[model samples]
Target: MASTSRLLFASSFSHPSLSITTGSDATRDLWLKNRKVPKEHCSKISMQHNWKHSYKCIDGGSTRDKSRGKFYINATSSQSHESQPQSFWKSTKDIMHTLQKFVMSYYLITMLMSIISSSLLAVENLSDISPKFFVGLLKFIIPITFMYFYAVGINQVTDLEIDKINKPYRPLASGKISYKTGVIFTISCSVMSFGLAWMTRSKPLLWCLILYFAAITCYSINLPLLRWKKSTILTLISNIPSMLLTSNVAPFLHMKTYVLKKTTIFPRPIVFTIAVMSFYYLVIMLLKDIPDIEGDKAAGLQTLSVRLGPKRVFWLCVSLLEMAYGIAVIMGATSPFLWSKFFTVLAHSIMAFVFYYRANSVDPEIKDVSQSFYMFIFQMMT
Candidate 1:
């Protein structure tokens, strides 16, 4: 009877159809050793050696089975790494969209064009283009880009609440980026602008960038004593210098020494350019507030549009731009070059007409018309 019971127990231990319980470390170790599982599966199998967590070695193949408190990784899934490029491109597009909202790429393009035009015009001869001219032009690009980024970033950081009302879709106001990130980016850009300007070894250019930075800061920052944007006159006074520097004076200063080998004496074209831009920008500033009248009023900012109403502000902006075009026509007609007269007169006249008609057709509630007109002004400058 004892021998018969012993044989039955031994057979039960070797039975293939029976399910083995891995309740202890000894059983788990015994099962692993008896199966002689591959090294890859051994590591994952060994991790589940706990009283509650159970694992099974599926009999069909070398694949390990995952259960409660246990894990398994498929080698075939490594092919998912192939999707990395697509993931990378999607991330890149998202970043670019964010940057567009933060920095206003359309405005940046126009600013770049204005800077390049002013630089080229400062040269007395078109034939003066050379390697050095290109090199100097290239050098100006970094400082310009950094300064504008700093300006926009800092403004967005400071005006988060205002932007929630005025421009809710913006990266900062929409919570796409944190306020701390915006401040850090702004500070870095500002520092880089100055550092790159210093690298150019031009004290005058550096001073111009400094002044521009100051103007932007004064216009955007709500300092107790220096909140220039709260008043129309102060806003215009603060922003004009920045516009002039980015559009005319700084570029002229940069190129004059390189292309002309001489100091600029306020050439006629440059003078006219600054005058037209200054007046146009003043109009733009006023018109810009027209779309934000509600926010400005609620915030007690006292902008021109809050005082004058959108329709009046719209017409006023159109009239001012027309006046600028008229001046351009006069300057064009008197120019020594026939091509200059023809192009300037024709372009300005068309733009003036476009502004008048477009501004009249726009709905007061939406900013499309006013903002488009603003872009149009910069387009002409370019």
Candidate 2:
């Protein structure tokens, strides 16, 4: 009831007597904050992103999606409608479209399937995989949705540096969207992420969202702190908790008693999966550092490449990826059942190395190879 009241009171369309143009910038920003946040309906992700953008007075719009981006404006029947980036009226109407674009671009549904399915199959090896679409949708949405907003917020916030250097076309830094608007929208999306997750009642998914949000927060901090080394480990290490929680606990979590005790559902395999996925995810995360070395150095990021020099980072990526291969070999040699999966993992691990290795000399090419390798690995998991 409070949320409904706040929404009604905060809405400009509800009272055409209120002129948006007459409002002060502070008033406008506040209204927007209220419209979005609205007496704390902002939910879980709100806190994660709000800290970065609430007071931000930085620089950057909306053309299309987009693959991400931000926009702001109030709506009404008058000039507010006509003057909005589109019609102010459409601004409100288009929100659904904006959300749709966000969901589609991030492949939210598919991603939920990626982790949840893999965990289900690998653990239960379930022959009858009749996924509850609603549940799958919830699980699928947890990670990708969080990632999509965080990426936008992080890009917008951190874009201050990138714009002055290379990307002057970004929304926040380029002036397409105000720092405040971008931040608010990002927070709203984050809130929506958790709000919707809660609706699904999937504790594992909720925990994954919380942890992933934290990792991204850490990513933003690392960018400024020059904890490049720690960031590398974090990029990979953080996934450990999620891997254990989701893959191990989720499937077997007697959806009945699941409500009673979620944490006590631990098993040894989860610990092992946690360590393995962390190592693999870490390798992928660090692979990105190689290409960004120069930009990182210039921005004072002190990334692994800048800290260890480019050659060392390259060898390190190779060495780390190869270690995955070695581990696979050992699994195959010993546990035949695990080895079967190991073969699948080993092939992709080596392929990831080949992609990284071939692109070692070039920077831009690295992301494509790495992404392709990610796709390859995901396919194997499927």
Candidate 3:
């Protein structure tokens, strides 16, 4: 009987849920009395060992089968551990999705345009390609990137309802990001952009940012006697200046006056670029509305697409872009440099042909087709 009691105690002590505590002889005697273990066996056991033990439930709570002397660990803890990484990845995916909606392809295109325009101007100014040029270019790009995001964000915030109808997948429209969050994001971007431009101490860059901000404000903000986008003429007025600033004039002046440390002058290439881009941007401005005609009409926004039928506006935009390409081809053909002449003429001719092909294939009545063509136009600009 003593041997059987000792074996029982050993097994109980070795159980996962049981913990042992060492104690004095009196405490061991008390434990032996309570457990009814034989005194002989208790005496044989080491005096330093105390049989007093307690069962501990693993975290997240546990259940024990007293009849079977079994403990079941809670699955909640293991499940939580497994879900942590998944939860983190899900959150990351959500953030990226929201960013994609906020900073669409157009904003990226804007940044690319700014970088290309600035880099070209830098190349013209500097005798050698150096780190300083890249550094300055980066500085310019940082502010422009923030500003472009701000422009798109603010527009989305203001046009949330319209986007719901026209672009349901957008963050604001889809409820991925709240209106208040979008407003805060745009405000933050605007502050960062202005702060960076101010820190640069470049008057041209500062002015350019300011002008772009004002143009977008007039184009988007719904104030009394404002909202330039409501009227086609007012929309063009706002867009033309913004386009010139974004694609040509502002970048050129900023690079000349700030990065190159030279007097501002519009060279022949700058003027030609401005003219070409102006025409291209004009086409974009008109074409972009075609896909959003349904929403615009519902919102009582008389865009060219809403006023004049989508077909007419579509053809007009195509014709205008074709004209711009034709002019570009002529300009390229007349270039003084043989290489420039050959490449420019060849590139424009090919682009013009591709644009014609793509335009003919698009059915403006289909929103997806019109939207694809709109993106195609932006791709051509880049």
Candidate 4:
């Protein structure tokens, strides 16, 4: 995780406190000269009793050490030895650290979660809390919390290459979290995510879980393998679950609850607003990838902006609000006088787009700055 974090930092290491590879030719050539296929080389090493080994990060990323023991670049891929030592406190601390790193680094996940939580709180706008919103919170938190952890593990597994090049500081990539350890944490999160969602016993929860699985699988692995990271439609759609999850539970929690004559929970206009709000988040996320374009390209990642050219994507990002607002006004006008919904929708749309456009200068730091601005504005706007 440290290595990956360092790589992430190094991916855009313009900061004075950090040092990372610039993906230069001298480095590549050095790696090639010293390179040996990890699998073939590691299989020959003996993994005996407990002993610590170290690898030096030479200019070419080749391992050398005074001990001269074999080093594994991706130990997870070639895990040998009986098993890693077990300790109750060690395990607990490890998982906690992983979760913390994930939350701290990915502002989008945190922001979306905040929005969802706040929106659900908004559902209480007109009334005190009840079973419906109680259920809604259950529906909202479990799926997302689980997905966040799951995403961290899966993203780490897939991003080993880029991490190696740019972020060699993350714990996992840096040998802080071993392959066995990472797998354990990933599985733990996945199982917990499913179990927690199942506990909710809500249709929305189940559907969201399914959607989350599909999105990660499709975007993180399948589509990338197919090299379709570009194409505005596909890239944008892959992020729907995240957007929807953030907005899904809010409307049901609204203050004005119309009880059907039959006494079952009735539909509210709040639901559509959640969807509209989520769309706004998705647009910013799209713009957030700008800095990563170069690193992603070097790593063979073809995200939408990377494929379409960042400038086009930037303008396209600016246009999304017009498109979204147009859709919202058309649909709302055709319907009833849900004036509150329209204004809320318009307000969030403008706020999200305006902040996102201003924040879309460059990626990495600029994106972080943009995200910070967006979060601040979103809080104020909401």
Estimate, for each residue in 1-382, the C-alpha lDDT of model 3 and write its tens digit: 6635444544343323222335565765674565455654453333223233442212123433323445444465567799999999999998987887777757476556655774575456346357766677777778978898888998899999999999898888999888898899999999999999899987777887898999999899999978889999999999888767765676667667677777666666776787788888788888889999999988999988888899999999989988998998898888899998899899988998999999899899899999889988877877
What CA RMSD would you report for each candidate? 9.9, 19.6, 10.5, 18.2
Compute the lDDT of residue 292 as modeled in candidate 2. 54
Q: lDDT tens string, model 2, 1-382?
A: 5534434344423332322223246653564465454434322111111222332111111011112322222334455555766766677766666444422432233345544543443333243334443355445445445655655575556546654454454555556566777677777777877777777666656676676667556655445653223444554555444444444344444231233332344444444444555555555555556555545666766556556765566566566656765665455455546656667566756765665666454433354444454444344333
- After superposing candidate 3, which stretches have Cα over 4 Å from the reference? 1-82, 125-128
Per-residue lDDT of model 1, residues 1-382, tens digit only: 4523432333333312223444566766676676554444343333223364656543211224435322233333344576778899999999888877787766688678788888888667767787888888878877988999998898788778888998898899999988888898899999999999888887557878889898998888877868788989999888877878876788888788744578758878888888888887787678778777766877789887888777777777777888988998899989999999899899888887876776677765566666666666666656
* Full-model lDDT for every candidate: 0.74, 0.49, 0.76, 0.53
lDDT of 4 by residue, 1-382 (tens): 4533443333242212212324444553444345442432332222221135322333122233324634323333123232444455678887888656643454444445554554444443445456764555555566666666776677776666666654566766777767777668777887888887677555555666677766765655544343224444666676655555534442233222321112224344455555566656666667656645656778766677677776676666556755666666556555666775677567656765665666465343454443454454345424
Ranking by lDDT: 3, 1, 4, 2
Which residue pairs show backbone clashes in model 1? none
Collision count of model 4: 22
TM-score of every candidate? 0.77, 0.54, 0.79, 0.55
**Top lDDT: which candidate number?**
3
Best by TM-score: 3
Which pairs of residues collide in candidate 3? none
- Model 2 misplaced stretches (Cα beyond 4 Å): 1-113, 122-128, 131-144, 163-177, 221-275, 336-382
